[model samples]
Target: MLRRSWHHVTRAASGIRWYVHELMGDTAYAKYVARHETLHPGVEPLTERAFWRQRTDEAERAPVARCC
Candidate 1:
């Protein structure tokens, strides 16, 4: 009984962690890597540093809705 309750708690905690990561954009690179792997099985995904640099460059080139 106690073990089952503990399992439920752990699963809920994991869900919360995933939610927070999604909310903060912390999982963007991970999602990109997964998609890249699926779409281009033989190619390598960009490194975190390179990913951020590319994203920044693209944003600068095509400035979208922003407040600042």
Candidate 2:
């Protein structure tokens, strides 16, 4: 019972961590890489730094008004 309870606690913590990372866009590159691999198997995906720069540039070019 103790081991099972510990396992549940660890799983819950992992889920919460994943949720926070996703909320903060920390998983964007990982998701991008997965999609890129599926869509363009032969091509190399962009580096994380390049990916963020490109994303930032695109956002800047097309500004969106948000109540942030």
Candidate 3:
């Protein structure tokens, strides 16, 4: 038996792995799904300073950090 057949887009990004569809840090999917985007444990595009700002604005994000 399945819990819920929820569908999500997934792929390996620059840093972490197994990111949720809404938290994907890629812009290619941003414009359309931006409204539904959410933050998850995965990569972020820090190639430029502005990229970080735009990403934060897009997702209202805060990185998931570990204590160790």
- Top model number, lDDT: 2
Q: Model 2, range 1-68, lDDT digits (tens) per residue? A: 99999999999999999999999999899999999999999999999999999999998999678999
> What is candidate 1's local distance difference test score?
0.93
Flag the better candidate by TM-score, 1 or 2: 2
Per-residue CA lDDT of candidate 3, range 1-68, in tens?
14332222222242235344336655444442443344423545344456566766867566667798
A best-first ranking of the candidates according to their TM-score comes to 2, 1, 3
State every prediction's TM-score relative to the real structure: 0.61, 0.72, 0.21
C-alpha lDDT (0 to 100) for residue 4 of candidate 1: 100
Supply the global lDDT for candidate 2: 0.97
**TM-score for candidate 2, residues paired by index:** 0.72
Q: What does candidate 3 score on TM?
A: 0.21
Worst 10 residues of 1 by lDDT: 59-68
TM-score of 1: 0.61
Ranked by lDDT, top first: 2, 1, 3
lDDT tens per residue, model 1, 1-68: 99999999999999999899999889889999999999999998999999989988987899578798
Query: In order, what lDDT does every prediction score?
Result: 0.93, 0.97, 0.46
Candidate 3 clashes between residue pairs 3 or more apart in a chain or in different chains:
none
Question: Which structure among the candidates has the greatest TM-score?
Answer: 2
Off by over 4 Å in 1: 1-16, 65-68
